[model samples]
Structures are given as C-alpha cells and as structure tokens.
Target chain A: QKEVEQDPGPLSVPEGAIVSLNCTYSNSAFQYFMWYRQYSRKGPELLMYTYSSGNKEDGRFTAQVDKSSKYISLFIRDSQPSDSATYLCAMSAVTGGSYIPTFGRGTSLIVHP
Target chain B: DAGITQSPRHKVTETGTPVTLRCHQTENHRYMYWYRQDPGHGLRLIHYSYGVKDTDKGEVSDGYSVSRSKTEDFLLTLESATSSQTSVYFCAISELLAGGFHEQFFGPGTRLTVL
Candidate 1:
C-alpha cells in the first residue's frame, strides 16, 4: 500500500459551497501535515500547515489532522470558481535528520459559478 | 515563485539523451529540492541539497544525480533520459525554521518530454 492515499477526485461543486478534502496515511511517525494547492500548468503553493493532531484556520481554509486515525482534512468555506485547482496533502517526519515530505495523489477540485 | 526560477521552462528530448534542469534561487534558503510530478503520482522527491556541495538522494533517485556547487544554484541531471522520465519537474527552496518546520516555496515547473 502507498504510504499516503487520497482520492483523485474531479470533485465538482457550485460556488459558495463548502468543500471537504481528505487524505489517509499509514505512517504513524508523521508529525507535520501540509496542504498544497496547484493550479493548471503551475507549481503547487502551500495553502495550509498544521503540526500533529489539531486544527488550524486561515481565512476560508481550515486544516485538521487526526493522528490516531492517520487522517488529515482540509475544509474550504465559501468556495469560489477561482478556487478550482488540485489539492495535495503531504506529511513528513524527521527522518535521517531531514524532514522530507511524502505526497499523496492529489484530488482535483472544481468550483463552478 | 519566491525568488526561484527554473531554466528551459519547456523541452523535448529523445530517449537515451542526457538532460539537465537548472534551479536558481535568490532566497538563499539553506535547503533545495528536486521533484517530479506525473499523472496519478502527485510529487516525488528526486534529490535534495542541504548546503553548498552537499547533496543526497531521495525516494526516486535511481537515474538521477544532483549538484549544488553554490548556495543559490542546484542542478538535476538525468544520466540518460527514458520514456519514464517524461514529467513535469519542479524545484523548491526552504530554510529550516524553529520547531523543525520547513515550508518549501516552489518555482515554476519545467515540462520535459522524452520521446
């Protein structure tokens, strides 16, 4: 099994709808969790970051991590058409003296007007 | 886009040819990474550099090598490209922050097509 698993969803939703994207990981040593948003033909940019098992909110985005279940979630409120992109979840532990992240297959999100 | 630039934004090469991608950063961050993105595989690290002249292999580093001769430049070279090496390549820079957190900033990707 892959270390991280995420649905490659072309999840279509209307503007102003609430969107929930999730990922499940099998590694228990992951202490840092991050969500990245990638636009078409562009590199991904960091959207949200959280440490361990907790929730962190930024604007319309909220990141939640549940270490016990090895699950992580990113919630988007008041989604907009401009928010259409691929969301990728990444986690990392301090291994070999470096924190190299392992990424999940991204979920594509489309918020239409 | 954080003071990072990748050269040859797009390229087409034949299999068995050697291809080199350049990543230049002005941020002077202590760490640099090379990754490739393919369909169904989000992003896989190929190599990373921790300091000048210091480099290490990543998860998928079999056919790849890297060099970091200066603080601001990291280069990834494919000894001999293959059809499987066709993918979008990205370079990211980061500095080790307090609490062992490293928030990476990526450059515009380089699209390489191996025919």
Candidate 2:
C-alpha cells in the first residue's frame, strides 16, 4: 500500500455547494499536514496547512487532521467555479534529522457554474 | 509566487538525449526540492537540498541527478532521457520557521516531452 492514499476523484459539484476532500495515511509519525491546489499546466500551490491533529479555518477553506486515524481532510464552503482544481495532500515528519514529505495521488474537484 | 522561476517552461527532446531543468529561487530559503507530476501520480520527489552543495536522492532518483552549487539554483539532469522521464517537473523551497515548521512554495512547472 502507498504511504499516503487519496481518492482520485473527478468530483463534480454545483456552485455554492460544500466540497469535502480526504486523504488517509499509514504513518503515525506524520506531524505536518498540508493541502495544495494545482491548476492545469501549473505548479501546486500551498492552500492550507496544519501542525498536527486539529482544525484550521481560513476564510472559505478548512483543514482537519486526525492523528489517531491518520486521516486528513479539506472542506470548502460555498464553493465557486473558480475553485476547480486538483487538491493534493502532503505530510511530513522530522525523520533522520530532516523532513521528507510524502504526497497523495490527489483529488480533482470541479465546481460547476 | 515565491520568487521562483523555472526555465524552458516547455520542451521536446528525443530519447537518449541529455536534458536539464533548472529551478531558481530568490526567497533564499534553505531547503529546495525537485518533484515530477503525472496524471495519476500527483507529485513525486526526485531530490532535495538542505544547503549549498548538500543534496540527497529521493524515491525516484534512479535515472536522474540533481545539483545545488548555489543557494538560489537547483538543477535536475536526465543523463539519457527516456520516454518515461517525460513529465511536468516542479521545484519547491521551504524556509524553516521559528517553531521548526516550514511551508513550501513552488515555481511554475517545466513540461518536458520525450519522443
């Protein structure tokens, strides 16, 4: 099994709908969780990040992490068409004196107008 | 937009040819990384540097090599490019914060196609 697993979803939703994207991992040592948004032909951009298990709210986006279950999620409130992009989950732990992040396959989201 | 720029945003080369992708950052971050993105494989790390001339191989570093002679520049070289090496490549930099937490910023990707 991959270290990090995420559903490669072409999840389609209408405007103003709430969207939830999730990822699961097997590493218990992961302490840093991050969510990135990537558009077509562009590099991934850091959207939200959390230190450990908890919820962080940033305007229209919320990030949640559960250390016990090794699960992480990103919730988008009142999504808009401009929110269409691929969401990637990344996690890292301070191992061997450095942190090397592991990434999920990514979930594609499309907010229709 | 972390003051990062990747050159040759797009390129097409024949198999067995040598190819290099450059990642330049002005943020002066201590950590730099190289990654490749494919359709199903979101992004895979190729290599990373912690300081000038300090580097290490990543999961998919078999057919590739990286160099960091300066803090602002990191280069990924494909000795003999293969069709399998054709993919979009991204460079990222992270600065260590007070609490040891870091946030990485990426540059515009470089798309390479090998035929």
Candidate 3:
C-alpha cells in the first residue's frame, strides 16, 4: 500500500464555509506531517506543519496529527476564493530522508463565491 | 521568498534531447532536492543531495540524473528526455532534516514540456 493516502478531491464549497482536508498513512514511522497548497501551474507552498501528534493553530488555519491512528488534517476557517488550490499532504520519518519521503495525491479544493 | 531560484522558469524540448535544469539557492542550505509533479501524483522525488559531491537517487530516477558539485547548486539532467518526463519540476532546500518539525522551503517551479 502507498505509505500516504489522501483523497484527490475536487471538493467545492461556498465562500465562508469551513474547509477541512485530510490524509491517512500506514507508516507509524512517519513523524513529521505537512500540508502544502499549490495553485494551478505554480509550485507547492508550505501551508501548515506539525510534528508527531496534536493540534497547531495559525490565524485561520489549524493542523492536527494523530500519531496513533496515523491520520492528519488541515482546517481552514472562513474559506475564500483565493483558497482554491490543491492541498497536498507530505510526511517523512527521521530515517527516510534518503528514500525521497512520501506524498499523497493531493485534494483539490475550490471555494467559490 | 525562499532565497532560491530555478533557471529557465520554463522549458520545452524534443524527446531524446538532453536537457539540464538548474536550481540555485542563496540560503546556503545543506540539503537540496529535486521533485516532479504530475497530474494526480502529488510530487515525486527524482534525486537529492545532502552536500556537495554527495547525491542519491529517488524512486523515479530511471531517466534522470543529478549532480551537486557545489554547496548551493543542484543540477538535474535528463540524458534522453521522454514525453513521460514532461512535468513541473521543483527544487527545495532544508537546513536540516525535518525531525518532525523543521520545514523545507521550496522555490518556484520550472515548467518542463517535452514534446
């Protein structure tokens, strides 16, 4: 099985709706979880980063990691049209650096007015 | 913003031709990586370097090769490009391993189109 799994969703939501994107993994070895946002024809930008498990909040975004279940999530409060992009989840273990890390297919989010 | 720049920003070449993409960083970061993004595939690592003269292959290193003779420069070469090799390439740098904490900074991608 792929180490990391995420829904490649074209999830459409109305503006001001709360958006949540998630990914699950089978590798308990993964210690670092990251969320990246990529606009069409652009590079992936690091959005939220978390280590191990727990929740981290920054402004309107929150990232949660559950090491026990190997699940991670990113929540966006008050979504905007500018927030429409592909959300990719990446994770790595301390020993897997040379192995190229693991990435999910990325969920496509579109917040419309 | 990443203190990193990717040259050619855009490239188009015929299949079977040799192509080189350059990634230069001003951050002096020790770790450099090359990744490609294809439709439906998040991003796949092609190669990475921990330091100068130190490089290693990633999962998709079949048609690609890389060299890092200098600390701040990492170059990726496709000896004989194929249509399958056409994708957006990204260069990233990290001061150290994430350790489940540190973040890797990414440069604007170079769009490569092989026809």
Candidate 4:
C-alpha cells in the first residue's frame, strides 16, 4: 500500500462555495501534516500545516488531521477563483531523521466565477 | 518565499546530454531537497542535503547525483538525461522549526525537456 493516498480530483466548483480536499496515510508515525497548493507550471506553495492530530486554521484555509482514522483534510471556505490550483498533502515521521517528507498525488481544484 | 532560487527556469536538452540544475537559498537552511513533478506522480524526492558537504539519496535518485559544497547552494546533476527525465523540477528548503518537518518552502519550478 502507498504511504499516503489522496484523490487526484479536478473538482470544479462555483466561486463562494466551500471545498474539501482530503488525504489518507498508512503510517501512524506521521506527526507533521501539511497542505501545499500549486499552479500550472509552478512549484507548490505551502498552504496550511498541522502538528500531531488537530485542526489548524489560517485565514480562509483550515487543515484537519485525525490520527486515529489516519485521515487528513484541507477545507477552504468561501472559495475563490484564486483558489484554483492543485492541492497536495505531505507528511513526515519524526522517526525518519527529520527531513524526508512523503507526499501524495495532488487533488486539483477549480473555482469558477 | 524562503529566499530560494532555481536557475534555468526553462530548458530543452538532447537526450544523453548532461544537465545540471542549481538551487540557491539565502535562508541558510540545513535541509535542502530536490524533487520532480510529473502528471501522475505529484512530487518525488530526488536528493537532499542535510548540511554543507552532507548529502543523501532519495527514492528516485537512481539517475541523479547531488552536491552541497556550501550552505547556500545545492546542485542536482543528471548524468545522462532521458525522455523520462523531462519533468518540472522543484527545490525546497526546510527550516528547523515547524515540528521536525516544518513547512517546506519551494522555489519556482524548473521546466526541462529532454528530446
């Protein structure tokens, strides 16, 4: 099984709607979880990050991690056309030295105005 | 914007040619990573540097080699570029903060085409 799994969604939605993107991991050791957004032909930019198992909010973006269920999610409220990009989930285990990160296939999102 | 810079934003090289990509950072981070993005595979690690003169191989480091002579620079060299190596490359720097695996900041990607 893959260490991390995410839905590669080209999900299309209207502007102002809420969007939820999720990822699941097989390793319970992942203590650091992060979400990154990428535009076409561009490198990914960190969106939101959470430590251990809890919710972290930054402006219009929220990141949730449920260690018990091995699931992580990023919720964007009042989504805008500017949010149209690929969302990626990345996690790292404290045991694996302190640098190597495991990434999931990004979920593409498009918000139409 | 972690003060990371990647050179040669776009390049097209012939297959079997040697190509080297550079990642320069002003953050003085201890951890530097090299990754490539493709259609199905989101981002795969190619190589990483722990500190000056300290480097390690990643999952996809078979066709690549890296060096970190200084704290601010990391270089990834493709010995013999292949069509399979035609992908967008990204460089990242991780700070000691952010819970062991801090938010990794990325550079603007380098688009490479091996024809």
Candidate number of the best DockQ:
1
**Better TM-score candidate (3, 4):** 4
For candidate 1, lDDT tens digit of each residue in B1-115? 7899999899999999999999999978888999999998889999998899989998899999999999999999998999999999999997677887888899999999999
Q: Sort every candidate by TM-score, greatest first.
A: 2, 1, 4, 3
DockQ of each: 0.87, 0.84, 0.66, 0.78
Candidate 1 CA-lDDT value: 0.93
lDDT of 4 by residue, A2-46 (tens): 899998988999999999999999988888898989988778988
Task: Put down candidate 1 lDDT per residue, A1-113, tens digits, no spaces.
Answer: 99999999999999999999999999998989999999999999999789889999999999999998999999999999999999999998866576588999999999999
Between candidates 2 and 4, name the one with more favorable DockQ.
2
TM-score of chain B of each: 0.95, 0.96, 0.94, 0.96
CAPRI level of candidate 3: medium
| By lDDT: ranked, best first | 1, 2, 4, 3
Q: Which pairs in model 3 have colliding backbones?
A: none
Superposition error at A58 for model 3 (Å): 1.0
For candidate 3, give the lDDT of residue A54: 99
Regions of model 2 farther than 4 Å from truth: none
Model 2 fnat? Answer: 0.87
Q: Model 1: how far is B66 from its true place, Å?
A: 1.0
Ordered by DockQ, highest first, the candidates read 1, 2, 4, 3
Q: Which stretches of candidate 1 lie over 4 Å from their true place?
A: none
Q: Which one is best on lDDT? A: 1
What digit string (tens of lDDT, one per residue) describes model 3 on residues A1-113? 78899999899999999998999999888877889888897778889788788999999999999998889999999999999999999998867445345889999999999
Instruction: Assess each prediction's global lDDT (C-alpha) against the native.
Output: 0.93, 0.92, 0.88, 0.91
- Listed for each candidate, the true contacts retained, as a fraction, are 0.90, 0.87, 0.70, 0.83
